[model samples]
Target: MKRKDQMIGSAFLCALLCLLMAVSGCQSMEDQNYTVPAAEKSETVNLKFFGNKNEALNVVAIEEILKAYMEEYPDVNITYESVKGADYFDVLMKRIRSGNGDDIFMINHDTMLELMKTGELADLSGLPTIEDFSPGARSQMTFDGVVPFVPTSISAFGLYCNLGLLAENNLEVPETYAEFLAACEVFSEKDITPIVANNDISLKTLAISRGMFEVYKGGGAEKALEQMNADPSLLAEAMRPGFEMVHLFIDRGYVDAGRTLKTEKTKDDLADFATGSYPFMLTGAWASPRVAALNPGLNYKVYPYPAQEDGSVLVTNVDTRVAVNARSAHVEEAKKFLEYLTQKDVMWEFVDSQSSFSPLEDNRLSSDPAVQPLNAYMTNGRSILGTDSNLKYPIWDLSKESVRGLLKGQSVEEVLGDFEAGLKKSQPGGAQ
Candidate 1:
């Protein structure tokens, strides 16, 4: 009897010991025999991050976010490097080619497709918490269901209507192209330079072209992307109507050709709109807050670019995305880092800090100032479509040259024809 009791006690003690250890292990990821990658197995985790320009993207936010991550995985060492938004592409390319690109990097929506095609980006197939992402948003983050990146948030492109300027002229929101023009005319006549755009040629071109193209094609960014990837031969007449609307704006003498030639920054246009009191500025939602700050209770309401097809067409932009180089020496660590960043807690805090809108679905939509209006756009009566959603790469890229030539002297048809030809040459078995 004594022996049996002792045996039973030993078994109970062992089981209890295991249960206690299991509970402890579950409590802290930090109390481990090894830091992630088991420092015993790997020598070191050298990571670098590249970010775009934004107030919340400043050093303080980056540091705090990374520090939180480090606390969870003590063995990792990360470095933060950034460039001005305008000069970022240049520096990023240089670093990437020199084998020093950050482990995690920011990518443009337009570039994501091209990058994925080249297979230089890591396949984030099983990223943590991706199941929590916004539904359609996944289309932007993936190339054919193969997750290539993790986006922090989504952005939007809309009209930053200067309500005060509109009120001064007794203008209500313009309901049609003609009304839009009339409102501009009033501002122009008053020497307010009705519609101001950033001097950056690309932005001006996209702002003017994106709206018209979407209205013309009757689709969003993804459909247009498919056409671009499919055939360059079919783009001419399809794109003609859109280009015509753009020319119509210039023909009215409302948009200043000379002004665009002299402009290199949106600041020129934004400053003019904010301080110069220009009646309209075609820009992203980010501009909405800045203008509000410039003139408190400015009575401004953000509007989507008026549809040329005379329908509701909203230009949606995806927020910055996190992509790892497939070629990176430390791909495992990099992939783990990307997955960690996508966690609901991590992403929410990042977006909260920036006050930028996020599409993460796990958490409730934000109610804060910066993100509030954007969140409303999702629920409000306004229709939303991805900006480059259906844009054919050729049509999208062609806008640059077409705008330059049309702005200079080329007839709209001639410029569009040239644009089509360029696309044809890029397609296989076409006239390269």
Candidate 2:
């Protein structure tokens, strides 16, 4: 990472540290300062996770889980090569290809395809019962015909509205694209600025622009997949709206693009939301625990991303995947471990225990109240959705670059043109 990006990350951590200290429930599943648990003596099991979850919190919780696992297995010596979310994939991929990926590894949705190609993932079929798991996670674990890992946790992006802010403003949460834009208008005129977004292709905005387009191109996921596989340019036209929306958000002031360089960090949003410096956040479920923990008494709710088309609301599940490396020396054991993690009993426990949503049709694991509204929205069956298939290898290598450039003032058409060119260059069989 560049020095500037590193500095931004540091500032983000600093802000989060201050907010977590002051907020009531900011402690992650475990405190980073805690000691490792003493489990039953077991063989040294070496496994590594490349996840970028709450870095500090995940470290302890993950260690604890391994401790419990070791208690049962009693012969596992787990070696972790964990990296914080900061430049996680960049570091993880290098380690993995060099024959150093953990016994098991965690990856973002974006890199799953390339990782799968290295034949490093283990097939998790019949290893665990996932019929009760969320389809989104199940599908993500499998690329093409190969099922690699188990679904552990899900991350969702939606509205983080401050009920108090709305009540004071005499406003109801917007239900359509127009209402949403209107709400922003009201907030901006009130000099409230109304939103605290990082503005640089991060969560909320990234979903609205890229991920949403991936899903909203609607009724065409399969086709889009084929198109990208054959000739990426064939799908460029469908991507125009995604590019336009990024520009739209900035032009309409839904996001202050001018401040993007300084605020493109999650910590910035967390700080503003906690201090009531901003009342609305266009983020994901990852922020839910923070809201609940920080202001137990505050009134807040999550809403589906508003859409321009009536009844055209779409959701793109972009995170939550676990995969095994086909080349792993302990592929069999890794398979069993991942299967255990996805068992209905285990998956639900993981979801509830961690305060998250499961894509499983099983109603047993309840949702975080903030995003419960999705149940009704999803139940209505009016939603057309898709997963973050962009992680499907070198095909999408240009994804972030194309989007980042578009957001940084390049033309949508030009970005797509360049993206198609890059896609052709990177295709295994070569573009048609």
In order, the Cα lDDT scores of the candidates are: 0.63, 0.61
In candidate 2, stretches whose alpha carbon ends up further than 4 angstroms from where it belongs are 1-43, 55-64, 79-81, 130-140, 199-220, 311-314, 361-367, 382-399, 429-432
Per-model TM values vs. the true structure: 0.77, 0.77
Q: Highest lDDT: give the candidate number.
A: 1
In model 1, the clashing pairs are 198-266, 220-389, 220-390, 221-388, 221-389, 221-390, 222-389, 222-390, 224-390
Overall local distance difference test of candidate 1: 0.63
| TM-score (C-alpha) between model 1 and the true structure | 0.77
lDDT of 2 by residue, 1-432 (tens): 699999999999999888877786556656657655677434465665556555344455566666667678765555555554436678878878788776677765556766766677777776647566656456555567766656666554566788888878898887776777787788888777766665433423443444345443445566566655566565555555656666576666766665654664456666667666565777655566666767677788766666554533535353457777777777777776776666565556555544455666564534577777655655464343334553343423355566566556777678778866776666676565
Error in Å for residue 22 of model 2: 80
In order of listing, the candidates' clash counts read: 9, 21
